[model samples]
Target: MSEISQAGGTLGAGDRNRSLTYIFGLMLLVGFGSPAAGLVDVPITFFLKNKLHLPAHEVANFRLVAAIPLYVGFLFGFARDRWDILGRKDRGMMMVFASVCAAAYAGFAFVPVSYPMLMAAVALSAVAWSFARAAEQGLASMAGQQLAVTGWMSVIWSMAASVPYLGAYLIGGALSQALEGRTAEQAARTLFLVAAGVMGAMALYSAWKPKFLYSHLKAEAHADRPLQDLARLFRHWPVYPALAVWFLWSFAPGSGTALQFHMQNTLHASDTQWGAWNAIFAAAFIPTYLVYGALCRRFTARTLLFWGTAVGIPQMVPLYFIHSVDQAMWAAAVIGLTGGVASAAYIDLLMRSAPKALQGTIMMTAGSLYWVAIRFGDVLGTRLYEQAGGFGACVIAITVVYALIVPVLLTVPRSLIATREGEVLPLEEPALEVGAQETLHA
Candidate 1:
């Protein structure tokens, strides 16, 4: 077999690049299809503040409901790994999810942006996006190992996640303005219509399908023994600490929702300025991803994680002191710059630690921890901001908690640290056969 599947089936650098590019787009679209995040997030938040006059905690509550599906995304991941859609694996499921998401958003355009309606609509979108996102990650992990680009998967995936936010902040200011003149109902129709259009495009793309995705390699036999693979999730020791690290790093009280409200209400910033702050913050990461990717090629995961976390924790402290939008943007840049190493290293660890056969379950579970943390953080942070001495208190707590992440690193298994040095992770093949033969069809 070719090392990096090439034209003649011999894998080469170019083949890996091509595969990585494809996976990058796959990850980006799944993340971007998210209607209420990144650049679009500003509008969503502004809508709540303007239309409903929701306080920070109430907004956090909204986010909690929207994000709940993400917290349980492992169920969807498990389903993806366990069965093929209409007897198809990644390909069929991709189409199924894209179409549903497209319709869900389009239908949302017709609803009132009232609390109940918005909550229900966001819930549906979250569930559909979770399934699609999990399916794509499984595809990426399997294909990435095949192409030998696993080392840089985090950098590329983070790029997919943040690059859109960068553009979203830059252009999102304008996107928000485009809807500003309209009433809340009209604005919901226009904004959600745009989101619907994006998902529609995704559906069309999935319908055509990419042959290389299915052609990458044969899957392991874990499909039939789904329960066994899930059982192994606990069986692996490294997973525990890795999960703990993800949770601790993410669970900052009121970090997202409260901080956002702080920016809007206290900073007295315009929507464009807020978007600019986010845009600048995201811009800081692009170069950092390049640097992190280069570093990962040369250094060990422990080396990167240790240093990355060290720098990142202090930078977040600056947010507690910012008085103006400009100062906040500068602070955002610092935080973003320091974030690269830790972000890249964390994904590298997860990529190395996840069982190749159970990639979906493991990665999504790690991701679910992140979303779960966000849900909890949103509520906790908001509550703390309301009662625990305001924004300054939240920042101090966040800084201290992140410091705890470094020690958790001590608990990761020795085997994964070795894998991070470029050894292969043995695939956990299921004892039972996967799929009815028909489901295996390309």
Candidate 2:
């Protein structure tokens, strides 16, 4: 077993370096894939509503309909862990999946107004996204042996993905405004073509840098764990509460996507102004990640979680009184900062609570549930915002949810803290040796 020491903490330093190298390479590819996924979805929904003359409610139903395959895709994480292609590494499987995703997006971009084809494309893209996300998360865990390191990895990965979105929103807004005489379908098709190009670039990059990822693939040795056994892992004293906290935290502002229209309506901001505000919001996230990494090194994960939730309280509470575009923009920035911290802390805590081999399964399961909660909350919050006649009610609702979860988040046991000087101690030689073996296989 090899060890690397930094700041008085010993970890799989050699594997960490290897993982970082691979993660950076993989993130570059995955980053492009993410924005393509998001960008196409936006235009697809818009096309369905305005261009195809579908009802807004029917278009909203697409969200619920889409959740079916998305959840199924998440379940495929278990299969992805067990299945391999061409007797090659997990990265090879991921590359294959990425290629499939690119093809699916291209299909969506080129295919004309057939509902069945559109739905099929969405399903295929969802499945590919799920597989790629699961693989990426597992690889991140392999690279980041500790909670703090994982936080850093997630932040970097997020920043990579965010860049494309920032550009898309800004550029797409300008293009939409300049091309106002064009039909809505034309605008949507244009964006889809652009997104397809991004996905194509991602596929090319993945093919170009196969070696970096090949060395980091690992098989799931815990695949044989029974369903009950896995369920029981989360049934423990702190685990269930921790999971609940995760749900509430994610659900609180889960309506942010829905709230954009509300902001535009209330503040009377143009589409370009909204895009610029969102860009600032996304830009605000970078510093939060950096701050989170630093805080994770100095404080316990529980403490960070607590502080994150605390910071989030003010962020949501102020939404009720925001009457101007500038106020909304500032609020968005604060939400971005607090949301980033809370997310990084929550994931760090989740990773610390799971055993190494089970991390992927545990995380995938949690993420599925989290997304479900977010979906539910988004619906509820949007209804409330519509009926209540002001943003205040929505703010109150989210703030209350955040307040309730803070204590539960704080109750996460100190043992789950992965900081070396605090709770996590040096691994015994035998355990390190076994971990080394797993890394070799991975």
Best by lDDT: 1
Where does candidate 2 have its weakest 10-residue lDDT segment?
426-435
Model 1 residue 264 CA deviation (Å) reads 2.4
**lDDT string, candidate 2, 211-312, tens digits:** 333333333354355574455454545556666777777676424444655666667777677667767777777788778866765776667777877786
> By TM-score, how accurate is candidate 2?
0.82
- Candidate 1 CA-lDDT value: 0.72
Against the true structure, what is each candidate's TM-score? 0.91, 0.82
Candidate 2 — which residues are off by over 4 angstroms?
1-18, 35-37, 45-59, 114-118, 146-148, 157-161, 183-189, 203-220, 223-239, 418-442
Q: Can you give the lDDT of residue 205 in candidate 1?
A: 61
Model 2 deviation from the true structure expressed as Cα RMSD, one decimal place: 4.4
Model 1, residue 108: distance off in Å is 1.4
